[model samples]
Target chain A: MQTGFLKSSPKIILRFTDYNSPFLGPSPTVPTATTASPSSSLQQPQTWICFSCSYSNFASTPKCELCGVKRPDALTSSSSTSLSQTQISPTPILGEHSPTASLGEVTSSPTLQPVVTSEGISCPRCTFSNHPSMVWCELCGMELGTFKIDGMELSDDGNVEKTERAQHVKLAFRNGGSASFNNKLKSAMTDREWEKITEPISVNPQTDFDPVRGGISGIMKNVAQNQEEQKETLDQAFKDLDALMAKASDMVKLAQSIKMKLNKDSSESEVSADDDSTFSTYLLELGMSNPVTKKDSGSIYHQELARQLAEFLSALLHKHKGMMVLTDVYCLFNRARGVALISPDDLYKACSLFERLDLPMRLHQLASGLLVVQAADHNDDVIAKRVLEYIRQKGSLTAIELAAIENASIALVSEQLQMTVSKGLICIDETVEGVRFYENIIINYQWDQQALQ
Target chain B: MSAFDFPSIYNFPPFFTQQPNEATWQTQAQLWISIILSYCRFYKIHRLDLSDALTTELFYNKSINRRLKLETLQSIIKMMIKQGLAEWDPPNKKTSAFIYWKKPEEWATSISNWVSENGLNNSIVTLYEIAHGEASEGTEFHEIDQAVLLKALDVLVKKGEAQTLQATNAEEMGVKFFGTG
Candidate 1:
């Protein structure tokens, strides 16, 4: 592992013994003992010279352990300057009777006094040394405590335990030029907005209502007031409208009955007078028409029809036996009830309603795992055709694909697919590749016909 | 081959990880599964001993220098198992699997119908004949794996529509009949 270039260069080695030791400077102008010191001979020099850094240190040292600059020249040099700066400073002497210095005052003073310790932190800006625990520097008046200090030794194992137990302080700002402790920082947070207020609800004897006495008294007073008012205003208007409605309905029935009688009376007339007679009467009374009918009783039949149709279609899509894609159902319902296009919300409500019915319509996924709806009276042939066609063209499809195609991702596609799969409208085809859909749904297919053939 | 030159992208380790995106991962996993299945099928590899050789042919990724390790191979097989594509022969046989690109049930049904259609019902046929003979020519059953065919036959036998016997100690024989049951 030796470098090729280093082998060609000449090597040098030196050994150190004391402060006056020759190894401190290269090409030492001093003599070496060259032999084992005789025990009775003069004791070796008490101090030593560090050969790597030229610094004076304790003698009888076997190696320069701090600089780690090995004495052997064969060792390649480490590029770092750590080996050249090991200096041992002499202990500083305390000056007695110094001006502006009191023994107790200097030790206890706290305001921005930089005290250097082994765990001292150096300010990057001012180079003022301070203990790591100090928040501000004494020399520069600069804040310095928040930084992370490294390479400092702990006095005891208790320091490690103390640091481990210390909690991080969280500071929060408050409005109106003030700040206070927020207890929530120390407690478990709730998964709710802070502004939500809880009010205490209490049962009070003064506020509770009595139903039996209140019901009878309230209805009696209301009935008396209505009776007195009915003689003059609102009730009379309804009474008059009721009489008019009866007359109008009677006229309609009389007209229908007359038309039926005329048709029955005619034995073999070539062209019955029903068409022109009804038309001419309308022409004669066109300007002088006084058609009297009560306008109040509203039309509920059309509304009931739409509601029934929506309910029926929803049931057809969701019932257990039938399975339809919601999109398909939407299209079919809209087409069948021509000119009556249901809104998306109504379509959704209908699906949920029918899902609640017996044998809920199940949503299913295709072989490509696309979403589809299955109604109770499911037309499997239609589903099989559509799903097969999709898978064939796309190679594969996911629920999102089916949803995009259907244009309604939320209501019809997801629920119906889940339902149909649960009900086995489709079989999940898993390959080493991934799950897919397959049309192995065992409905009443005529396998017997093929077998007989 | 001169130590198989690895593509630089193979050094990009993400290529070995199963992607999280559904479609992307599905396609990637499927492609790897298909490639491995086809390689194993062609090589008649029942067990993959990854330590045996650093053969680049098994994983021919030209653009990436990295190749599938044994663990990654097992993961791909596991993905296939999830899709019902292959099954480990046993829990301990993580390195060996019986691939069912068409599952045993599917194969059984297909074979039974093929037999009934060809009027091979109630007739005995040798295992070799069923796999490579003229009768199975141009069909999915042609050159079928013997162990896979045995499992399919075992399914049919349990259903009472087929029975199996050894025509010789070294030979396999099976008979089937289309039954209403």
Candidate 2:
């Protein structure tokens, strides 16, 4: 089958070139004569029946000469059979006449001849029917065979020579992936396998009945079909996204219900110590169903954020021993909110509103200028007393040792020890081993007997 | 003396560190002053070299691996000068100072008592004899720093109880004590 198509392909090219010679400007006739005689030996009938309108066309005609429908087997069959005996006798005379006679036959069936040529390799970029021998489109200059022409324009003057101006069409792929598409197109062109894919579509009778075969109406039908397909795909994607959103909400609700059950169980008895309750509580912490957004709390954004932060941190502050670094709070709060993460400046501004809003959690700045979120009840005196007691017990304590003992940040411990020093409860010893704090024993020494004597 | 007994506070690591607080540091300065006076008195040390003192056990505690900084020692010496317990030896340079374990007036009272007890009132005594002569053996003034002896004699002269006679040589420089009337 492939060999027959290859053998007939040159004759098909000769016929098209001879038919197009008027616009292409008169080519040599010797090669045409040589190619046409052998094609005549293929013994095609003088006339053939059109499947669409059932009109009998001469073997030299590529389309239905009566109704302008393309012949289905034009690629493989070098020719088609005649319905009447009168048409059959003229086949031998036409074959002897060859190029001039076939050209005359093509001119006779001239209505849709230029628009839909059977053997012409169409420029996929501009839908211009190019002579099969050209590697690039004469009108568009795009590499031939990069795309298969989906439809053709049916006009009296579909001739490329009639248009004097050079028409340029720029294809811009706005959504990216153009490089990959070009690579695939290049590979398809290189393999020359697109012909096989387009051959079946051209022969399929179902596609022949499609209105997109030719004319302005065909283009409108093609566009409408494409839009319908796009709408279907978009609707499917939105439906999947909606289903996923619903599942997420369901999961949140399930977590809330489990948390509620755990709370109730713990209130009634002390049996809520299992891993399931702990896991649920963890999930509950992660789910901040309603975060205070700037959009939702306009004008008083910082105040509202402060309130929300206080509520979020009250429980967390207890777990962290009533103090957490401002940066840590920002991370935890943003993670819990899951979306609409706040900037550090916004978090800082919101924390600044804690005192104005009288929130249970306050913003505290250490001597080192590090900001922390501290509980309202967290007092310097308490920390100082704790440090003093620890220092008294340990004889002397470095900031690092106290930080480890209290499981608090070194900055906080250092600040606490400094406060104790100011209060004269403890004194600092700065040395090569770093600063250490000791009980202020110098304050209680007897001045008279110890040195004045 | 019997290996000058260091106070219990000397063993404290923080005691070697200069205190940062004002009131605490004043107390710490006093403690340092007292320790210095007794340490100097026990060792009969009259002059303190700032740098040399830092390496000694007085300023550096080896077991605690801590040492008083030079600035801290200098400040402490300045406090001692303010208290009249010390004076810069050359009267201007700060690197070394004369530690006055006993004020010059107290030293003068000890010298006058020694003269009255030995029947040497109205008698002329060479400054060198008061510091290193056999007659001054087993006395608090024996082997006294020459500069300190001069200061003590100056106090006596200021009191009109003694007069210093200038001599061609410092060893012959004498102070005549008047009987306490």
Candidate 3:
């Protein structure tokens, strides 16, 4: 499309197919559509204006007889090389129209008739209006219809009802200024919008509601609330989906890891495909949607927080070393509870309550006063033996280096080393590089000598 | 000549630092005390100057990349004094210490045996002759400190096994061991 060079001439039908687009820009032109929608000018045929002579020609004629300008070929794809030079975007221009529709001769098949278009597609070069069938402008030889990227220009006539309900959700959220107003707004907007969108929840909630009565807490309460809020946000997305999809990408990582893990152990679980549908839905529910909070837990806040903390940590311990730094625990616990954030003091109190209970995991404070959570069955002596072996090999190394060896945190490793020092398994070395630990060969050798004697 | 023996624990890095824990500190102190005594005995170091040994390889362990901090070194020396393995010279000033790797009685036994073995019993010998004479060659007391030699002679004299010569000059005093004490 040397559209710039053809500026002086009448617009040419570089690709005659632009006029045959079923729907171009904002208009849907199918004559057989359910309604006699007059939205598209292409649906009706009319006179074709001569682009060069400024002479009006009959719709039946493909060219200007007086100017001897031959009719341009019906629209076809533009040569891709010069697409950017064409003033009208190429993909939106050609749309779905076919070349046969621009042929002047009548076809025997009922569906082959040229789509009668009154609304002339403006020439990219000459500013002249051309009939849908004209492959090239009568005046300029610039290509008429080159743009045709499918799916980008689909008509949304079918989704009108769905989109309207999504709008009502937006209105309600905007009107919610106060907390009570917001709550009411949430309930009011719940029906129709989300109900229509998520006819796909398909799977029932798998968690047993009764067996776990650490009391339902606020997690369940947030679920009903989430349905309303989630739909409202999605309704806002109906207005623009591109941004929403970008934001949703982060939510894909956890699902991918879970999917990878499931694929690795697929035979071990034998879970049905239906279970997987809810699994993705559960991923969307992440700690964000179902957090336990003071508003819901009330009198049993600390107690419930403690139990939830224990349950979460116990599961984590299976993956991590049997311990987590107190600071890390605070962050993860709060994240698992979502909007229900707890204060550090509150976390400490919640942890203290564990001492009074018979839980398997307890908060441990090291000799240096560094705090961590460790399982009751977890043994430091085992780590000590490993530390002893490690020190003997490296001769001596720092806690940070040992952390790398054991795949644990520096804080945890440092505390473990201190305990080993107390046990006389290894001894600490304070050097310029930092503190390192070495095998307590003195004690062992002394004992060995005594045994020999 | 006997080989100088060093305990294997000297190569350990932490062996240089005094432990922070009470029980560990006590054990490390005892280890250091033994190491110091053995090292002195091997080198035949009669007196240890705290100022000089502070920067020596005897205190700073390069293999372990650690050094005995001044505080830890002083503490170990004090523990040595408490155990009678060492005593501070000019007791109040405490600038240097006399390491008693061998007790006075033990030295007296060796000196008495050396005199009898060399047939020098009942024959008076000047202090210098006893300290540096050919008869003293290959003996542990060959190069014994004068103060330590005098102490050993005092032990023999106290037992009535040797007589101290009444010399006009104190420096020329000699001793006669009756027989192998």
Give me the candidate number with maximum lDDT.
Answer: 2
- Model 3 is docked with a DockQ of 0.20
DockQ of predictions, in order shown: 0.01, 0.32, 0.20
Q: Which ten residues in a row have the lowest lDDT in candidate 3 chain A?
A: A202-211
The worst-scoring run of ten residues by lDDT in candidate 2 chain A lies at: A147-156
RMSD of 2: 18.7
Of the true interface contacts, the fraction found in model 1 is 0.00
- After superposing candidate 3, which stretches have Cα over 4 Å from the reference? A1-289, A392-394, A446-453, B1-3, B21-31, B54-57, B60-66, B119-123, B163-170, B176-181
Question: What's model 3's lDDT at A4?
Answer: 37
Deviation (Å) of A53 in candidate 2: 49
Candidate ranking (TM-score, best to worst): 2, 3, 1
Residue-level lDDT tens digits of model 1 in A379-425 = 55554455555545664455566557655444444444433444444
Clashing pairs in 2: A47-A82
Docking class of 3: incorrect
- lDDT per residue for candidate 2 within B73-155, as digits (tens), equals 88999999999999997788888898999999999999999888888888898988888898888887788888888888899
Model number 1 iRMSD: 17.0
Q: Pick by DockQ: which candidate is best?
A: 2
lDDT of each residue in A322-403, candidate 3, tens digit only:
7778888887776555444689988888888887877778888887898888787777887678788888898888899999
Which fraction of the native contacts appears in each prediction? Answer: 0.00, 0.57, 0.35
